[model samples]
Target: MNLLLLKLTLIPTIVALVTLAIRKWGGKIGGLIGSMPWVAGAILLFFILEQGKAFGIQSIQGSMTGIMALITFCLSYAIFARKFTWLPTLLIAYVLYTLTAVVFDYLRLNLMLSYVLVLSYVVLTLYLFPSPTAPPADGRRLPFDIPIRMGVATLFVLIITGLAHVLGPNWSGILTPFPILTSVLAIFSHTLQGSNAAIVTLRGLVMGLLGFTTFLYLQAHWLPEFSVATSFGMAVVINAFINVVVGKIW
Candidate 1:
């Protein structure tokens, strides 16, 4: 119960802060930060605390597979953003995400293989995605925007974590990176700043996933041997280093 309350409070707070940071730094930096394991890391932490390291490892593997879905989501959104408004674009992208998730769920691959596949897809999508042609405009801020985002993020954490028990580690892992935060950010950016802004945001997200992939890779390899504190600490350090490299390259 105490942990549950902590999750409900902590995750949204982090998200709100990140969202504000995005507003301050602009989409590329914000998207890169947003791409960190904020949501999935939190979920896996709770999985370790409640279900044990074995469960966490299994979920991590599942999450690797799930990255394919995230790639699909980004690609779909980027493509459709060219021709459609945010609403229809989001709807269509979501449909693609769902289908991709289902397909990836049934077709399991080893972690290294999954990583290779996902990384390859990311590269292809990045190449194929059209540059945003829309003129830049400042996004309109609603007083309620941050609050709504906070509420929705918190709610998603609750629901996704609760469902993990029923879905088991693999399916839960696949669901871990469901693009909730990305969806919110993309929608708001599209509405306010235009399609190009949203495209930049998604591109940043894909780049940031390099750090995310490293975090999970370390956790999967190290968590079984080390204490959770030690394993997670090392993973964060490595992930931060990789993010720095990515930031430099980007």
Candidate 2:
């Protein structure tokens, strides 16, 4: 099978499952699962397969820096969701995410430094993340919701992977956590439920990034010395362990 076709098919299926899981478990769990490196990991895997191990390594480093942008995005959206409607909130958050990505793109740092910088921002964002004002009201599910979510996920993966060669590892890595799933979840939650729902979802995403950070850090160091399967497997195990610890603490 063609690799891109495989991505288009497999990723959307995973998105659909996660979407269903979100609905089943509630916004916070949804956010937690959603924040996992489903899309980002898949993209990086494709990079390794199609481009080369060296490219994947550089991309992982770039991805660590890009994570800061995701933290900013969730923080911005969480803050704005409390005051503004979904549309304006999304717009402002997207602008901030874009600008932050641009800034991170130019700043050169080794993997350890990037991890430290990102962790600082992550801690700060978690501290600043808005408390949910109220529980989210249940929204009526649309039949097409899953399909729409899948479509959006497919589109994003296609665009990113298609441009991987052109963007190179750095820019591609920067774009990895582009908030496609989070945006979809937030917008839908806001439109259907309310601002509080959106806030909860974004907070979940922010909290979930703890595991994501671990995943990328492991990948950056492990992929060169280990088989891809072994590297990802270990990363997932570590990520799940962190998620459990985070769940207990937070």
Candidate 3:
């Protein structure tokens, strides 16, 4: 019950912060902040407490797979956003993400291999990602936008964590980074701002995935040897460092 309350409070709060940050800072920095593992990290913490460290550690492979699919989702959405409205663009990109997730899961690559491949894929996808054609137009804000974002994010967390026992580690991990936040950001940006805004936001998200992927990768090794808090803390610092450097260069 306590955990449930935490999920209800924490996930929405983080989503609200990310949404407001994007509004204040624009898509790139906001997307970078969104890319952090707040949702996934919280979910992993719950898995560790409920399922055990092994369950959490084993789940990293699936999270890596999910990250790859997330990259595809971002890239595809950015590419399609130029030509279509939010609905068709989101659907097409979602299909691509599902297909990518399935293929990666079937291969069942080792952790290190999956890690390397995903990092490589991130770079390649960024290169292939559509360049922004124009700035987001001045679009009207909708009522209860933040509340809606919060509701969707909280619901996603509830579903994933509630089903942890049933999904087990691998499937849980795959679903961990399942593009819920990405979808919200993309759809909202597309609707409220414009396709260019959505594209920029996704590109920023792909860039931030550098740190996000590393955060998940380290957990595989760290979770077994260190306290959960310590492991997550160190991973976050490293994740921040990677994002700092990548943000400067990319």
lDDT of each: 0.84, 0.86, 0.90
lDDT of 1 at 28: 77
**Residue pairs of candidate 1 with colliding backbone atoms:** none
Over 11-50, each residue of candidate 1 has an lDDT whose tens digit, in order, gives: 8888898899888888778988898888888988888877
By lDDT, is 2 or 3 better?
3
lDDT string, candidate 3, 56-136, tens digits: 999999999999999999999998888899999999999999999999999999999999999999999889988778887
**lDDT tens digits, residue span 118-151, model 2:** 8778777878888888889889777798899899
Query: Model 1 residue 227 lDDT?
Result: 93
Residue runs of model 3 more than 4 Å from their true location after superposition = none
1 or 2, which is superior by TM-score? 2
Would you list the rank order by lDDT, best first?
3, 2, 1
Which residue pairs overlap in candidate 3's backbone?
Answer: none
